[model samples]
Target: MTSTVGVSGAGTQDYDVIVVGARCAGAPAALLLARLGHRVLLVDRATFPSDTISTHLIHPPGLAALERWGLLDRVVGTGCPAIDIYAFDLGPFVLAGSPAGEGFDVSYAPRRTVLDKILVDAAAESGAEVREGFTVEEILVDGGTVTGIRGHDKDGGTTIDRARIVVGADGLHSTVAKATAATSYAEKPKINAYYYTYWAGLPMYGQFEAFDRED
Candidate 1:
């Protein structure tokens, strides 16, 4: 059975679902739940138009999902160009082709700042309560089952939200995963270091290029 808890005289506030990390995964899940008429609370530690370290590339299948969710137009409306060509250089060989799939013939590399905000907006518009800059400090658990989350808002105010279901969509180093002991393969170490920044007027915008560098 699902349980709920109240915080700070909020009059027993409760939701059907509570989602942490309002990015690609969390926002979409929350949007779906809200569209299904479930009360949802979507929280994120970052504000809109803020950057996150991401490759931001969405393949045809991902584009198809976005289209099904009615968000592809919004993504393209942000002026993010679509990439149809792919090139891979393996030093001794080269492979170039365009990916074709149902309802999508290309891929996209929208900026993270723009993409994430669009997802969050869609979740909000679908009736999910979204809280930006809300940091999840703890995952509430009982009898070995996840219940909800305790966190802080942007104003540094503490908040304890409860729901029937709690989803941790936080990225790789997820707090919920750690608190629930749900992680594996901890022995793997970082392999490479990557540094990237956006630049304007790059002619390679609509082209996907990959290089194999051994140095």
Candidate 2:
């Protein structure tokens, strides 16, 4: 029960994999898939140059992905150096690794508006058709497999698209999840007491003393 409202005589005519969310996870996934030569459709409820605030930290594993896509060059080309981790709790703290031994490696920070635009454009250039102001209303399923989805285009009205493999890149509040009930585990909630903010121009060492999530 997953599909898209194929924009009729409008933006991005069609696609093979229609990703619902275009930020964070969805955007990157679409770009990679498109590079592999799939007709990818990238959609987002919000338009680019949009503001998204959070603890925007991508350490280690994400760097590996960037390396795979060869975007590490471009991201690093933006001038943010890799973050050096230093854990601090009781005192000057423990450096995650020896001065020249073990530790995680990753770049510091980049604004969402700046970074996401790069990813968005990369996906589009990779051949994924990216669009904004499109919202998915339901997942179209013909049987057991995810088929396609239906949503509204920016200009208005419902659009329907059928794909062989529909990816539910739409996170958390994903319409695909509710439509198919794909998960086996029950969801849980946690009480968080952290306020996230961005600190540009300041040297950001990974694992600062402020972040204590060992609860």
Top lDDT prediction, candidate number: 1
The residue-by-residue lDDT of candidate 2 on 96-148, one tens digit each, is 54122223344446667766777888888899988788888877766455567
Question: lDDT for every model?
Answer: 0.82, 0.68
TM-score of 1: 0.88
Number of the predicted model whose TM-score against the real structure is largest: 1
List candidate 2 segments past 4 Å from native.
1-14, 53-55, 90-106, 184-191, 199-215
lDDT of 1 by residue, 161-208 (tens): 888777778887887767777646535688777788778987765778
lDDT of 2: 0.68
Q: Give the TM-scores of the predictions, in the order they appear.
A: 0.88, 0.76
